[model samples]
Target: MKQSALSYFQYPEMVLVPLILFFVFFMLLLFFITRPKNRELFKKMEKMPLEEEETNNESIE
Candidate 1:
């Protein structure tokens, strides 16, 4: 019983390290996204799809 109890966690099935790492990553991404310095980049990315479509249409037949 004693060994079983200790060994239960040896494999570490219920872990939270990954969750914390993911949360940290999400927060960092949010910080970068909200920063004013990145606004222009984001705006360009936002319009990229539309620009691509327009360019495709402008190609001669």
Candidate 2:
């Protein structure tokens, strides 16, 4: 008898690959979130909304 390609993944072992990939991706996301960043850049971004057009022009000089 002939078997289809889908039959290969029916075994229980196929579950491990996806689980490991999910764990690795999750760990990478956590690592980036916990990592340190430039404080000055964040301060500039925070003040952007409050600054007016005149101050924006002066800063360009």
- Top candidate on TM-score is 1
Model 2 TM-score on a 0 to 1 scale: 0.46
lDDT of 2 by residue, 1-61 (tens): 2367566647787799899999999999888656668556767888998787554445644
**lDDT per residue, candidate 1, 1-61, as tens digits?**
8888888557464467888888999999999889999889988998886774533457566
Report the Cα lDDT for residue 4, model 2: 78
Compute the lDDT for candidate 2.
0.76
lDDT of each candidate versus the true structure: 0.80, 0.76
Off by over 4 Å in 1: 1-14, 54-61
Error of 1 at 27 (Å): 1.2
Model 2 stretches astray by more than 4 angstroms? 1-9, 38-61
For candidate 1, report its TM-score. 0.58
Candidate 1 has its poorest 10 consecutive residues by lDDT at 52-61
